[model samples]
Target: MSYLPDRVPLHGPKFAADPHAAYAELRRMGPVGRVELSPGAPAYLVTDYRAALDLLHDTDTWSKDTRPWQQNQPADSPLVPMLGWRPNALFNDGKAHERYRSVITDSYALIEPHQLRRQVSKVANQLIGEFAAAGEADLIGQYARRLPLLLFHAQFGADDQEGPRLEADMAGMLDSQPDKAIQANINFANYITELIRSKRLQRGQDLTSWFMDHPAALTPDELADQIVLTMLAGNEPTANLIGNALSRMLSNPAYYSSLSSGALTAHDAINDVLRNEPPMANYSAHVPRHAVHFHGTWIRPHELVLVSYHAANTEPGPTADEKTAGGDDGAHLAWAAGPHSCPVKKPATLIATVAIEQLTRRLHDLELGVPRNELRWRPGGFHRALAQLPARFTPIAPDPDGVSPWTSSSPYSSTRQDKTWSPKPPACATSGPLYG
Candidate 1:
């Protein structure tokens, strides 16, 4: 609590641009540091990991409600409006939270991890094959953006063409006001509406079908909300992770080739990627309820405070002086910790694993089509993603030249045999694909 200097800096672009700098200073200052949320609102940063863990885990102390502070402040408080939705269990705590979140968390048990492995590898292969022939292409726009859509599509048994439009709408809501978020809500609602309706007619193994059968437990609209929320939370972060991971790995030939040649395991690749470039630099936690107090300062019931997931991962741990690449077991706060941690992180991890593993397995000596420094990353927020990740590669010898080509359209079929990708022989180069 005393970490806050007598004078605290106001939260604005500086804090958003790089909160770590301020956090680093705050950490040095000690436990709780003071900072301003707006012109009049005084807030404290819970910098110490022990204390932070307390806040993120204890629903009794903090309330997720925005009401207390919102009501106290003037109606036009810009701070009230700027803080966005935390729809998942991330914002809730205690009994009410456990009840709602349990529905989704229990659903995770039904996600066939083994089944997903083969399916996701196929998805990875399909996308990577597109760039494999050309030698390279933007990993983010071309694949990262598409892979999650593909996963969500298969997971819920959705139609092939729905992802792009839905993802775009979700992106729009992330920026628009809550009132305006309704449009996206409606768009997503309509889609899920139709999806569930059809499933009712002829149910499949997809979770949506499960919900359809359990209509006694969840109404069609509630089921649709669950699906919509899952999509919003799962889609972008996973896409950004894939983008961040691929761009980081593909940037260095030594690292890229190691995986391609099977020198390093996909497990190693995913671990290292997360350490170097986590999707979120920082993720915020809203107070679960009132009475959560850190130090002498009150996080005060429903108030919103941004926990530095970025800072927590990089900060010195109890035994180690710095962060370590411990994989899913890593103390890395990227997936968060305790009650608010992402339950689907395993599935998310496997999703990334499949993509990286299969893609690297397929491609040979990669040539950097775009300079590493030339790549653009999402700069202002937690999700640091490359706008594009382009690369080039030389095909294997003998009949090498015009190599394997990918199908023009992205596949929706989860079955691999039905979705065969031609690994065409590498082309004979006038300049050669790799040379180009």
Candidate 2:
């Protein structure tokens, strides 16, 4: 007998707590099914691997525009903060998407990989230096969260003072409620406008300057929007990618040993994380140009269609041969696909790799400060992120040169017992802040 799964609610603490288990249930019901995003926003979620690819690639039939759906949505809906229309490539299609995407992708491509690696290493080392001496630190706030922001700031000609503010504003925009998120968006827009103006007056050796010279000749507003899109695309997902990979390494003894012993490469670990728990767990929302029957489910025209990367990667129907035979080793939708695929994927991967490699190499004995299960997953359906990656390593001396780039006020201190990190700590520990 065929089974009919109950309609699942995609928002709230329950879904965020253990989304994979929920996806497993959804797959059992059917590859495509109805689900509510937040309270009143209901949409169809695509859970199967084959179906997701089809939906992502068929942009001709499934446009990125959401005007059809937004016309009826309440002004105060929480999901609107996330899925609402914007002028950037993320929200447009056809010639507009091409124009925005051309400039953004070309600007990103100008940064040579080797040069980019040097910058990533520099930022990684500076961040590690700041926290390494403490012997115990929250990796998420101190390292994972700060590394990408600082790198982006450096490229945008922003200084250390701007780093924290940019991080906070973007975080608020990504994960806050409707009111706070909208305000954060406004603050960020103003900040970008100023940055672009500064670049126009005196061109710098940075992406912002390169963007100004591009042939697209974007208006000031378009320039600011594109920069915001590029920064947001790389910062949040890459941070979460690093965090999720570190969590897996610390929590699973076998994976840790493989990484330490060089049996598994950093790329391998990254691929594993991308497949099992992607940074953007639920994204690539598309609106069908017309009402159509997809995989036995009728989706209305312009309905918000979301792909669950976590579920697609874990679908149980594919045979071992099917899984390993044709697709690329990293054949996961974590980087997304089609024309709108992440443009900075190469740099993002390199950054995550160097960050993980540098941290483990510097603190050879680093271990999780809290129990594996006790680490709180932040509440959000759009991202799979750990609240804090508390970890402990042997204390080390501070840099003699006093040249560390970190702030004088260290966020981590050596308080935990001096032992190898444990995967089983008491459950009463509080969640750490998202940023230092």
Candidate 3:
């Protein structure tokens, strides 16, 4: 008999360093490989492209609900915060999923493409202006990470001051430390609770208000749950997308030049990243409703199954001509598939592409401060995020008119003046725990 490890570990620095290698090893086991997200948190990771699609599209056989799987997990398992059952669409099925997803999709639809592009450009300029004069900046920390948070805050009509807190809370939740992740979960819930209460009292032209006014008429608790899902789901992955795209462009001169000369668009770079180094590499968690054979593997009932977007996208299968004839755009499962695919795909793409375009345009000569090989990837099973993207460029000074040189000629030049809405304090404090 062929020898196989008990379970391949998806976490830790070793896997983060080169996950593709790990995925290759997992392939020896079959299309679906047994993997541990963390100690004692095992699942079946779909590494084959066809197998991943099979699982993603077969919602009737494989459920999005995680409660049944969570019941078998230790209470202190760090995965709970991320994969735990919630009232949102991510953990629901059928009508409940449709209802929750509609609110998000409808609210996002309210943000026109032009408006979203303008918003991304405005925030990109603001963030770039902070580091433009410094000659060097950690693009991931100063730009990629903050841009999405600020945009989400604007979308939700949240206080700018709360941005850092939300970012920290998100970091905690994604951290491997169980205590920190649990605590961050509590803090994030409180933050959403306060946001909903505030929006209920004073409505604004924002997603929170739109969610509240949506025909679904979600209850306060439901609203809180949905917001938690939306903000975290949108923020982290979008940030990683920006970071990954920028890293790829900066490390590859020909690619960067093509981007600058308009020979290749930001969309091209973004798409390339989506295909190879997707931000959320190993997610789209699903549970098999009952024991069944899947792609030649016998899966247990309620077994945790995760789709490895990175592995599946890069899995060696398609020929070059076949890929070309079929078109490579829709083949990747980065935004996932079927009932649980990403709802904000358009907005997320717009945000990342615009963010990269604005940054590269402003810092035309931006290059990696350290060797590309030296750049560190954040250790996690779910996300393919860079710890930092340090970059250097010729410093640009503010114009005599006190406007950022980067923003003065922007397409959305009047964005600063046009943005007038500010956040309002909550009408009342949220008391007690967000969940029982």
Best by lDDT: 3
| CA lDDT of every candidate | 0.59, 0.76, 0.81
Across residues 112-212, which tens digit of lDDT does each residue of candidate 3 receive?
Answer: 67778777877787788888879999999999999998888888988778887888887787666767877997988887888887887888878888888
Model 3 regions more than 4 Å off = 175-180, 320-329, 399-417, 420-436
**Which of 1 and 3 is the better model by TM-score?**
3
Off by over 4 Å in 1: 1-19, 26-29, 32-45, 67-88, 129-131, 171-186, 214-216, 252-254, 291-293, 316-330, 367-374, 394-436
Model 1 scores what on Cα lDDT? 0.59
Clash statistics: count for each candidate: 28, 1, 0
- Estimate, for each residue in 1-436, the C-alpha lDDT of model 1 and write its tens digit: 5444553454455554455676678677566666565567655556665565666666566555555555666766655533433343444456645644555655544555666676677566556655555655666767778788777776677776776666666555554376666576677667777788777777666656654444235655556656776776677778877766666676655466565664556676566656545676554546545454565565556455656555555666564233333323455567766665776788788888777666665564545577776765544434555656776655422112222233323232122333422222222112211101
What's the lDDT for residue 193 in model 3? Answer: 80
Q: What lDDT tens digits, residue by residue, belong to model 2 across residues 267-335?
A: 777888898889998888788999888888888896888888878877777853575433333457787
Q: Comparing 1 and 2 by lDDT, which wins? A: 2
- Candidate 1 lands at a TM-score of 0.74
Tell me, by TM-score, which candidate is best. Answer: 3
Query: How far is each candidate from the true structure, as Cα RMSD in Å?
Result: 9.9, 9.7, 5.9
Q: Which one wins by lDDT: 2 or 3?
A: 3
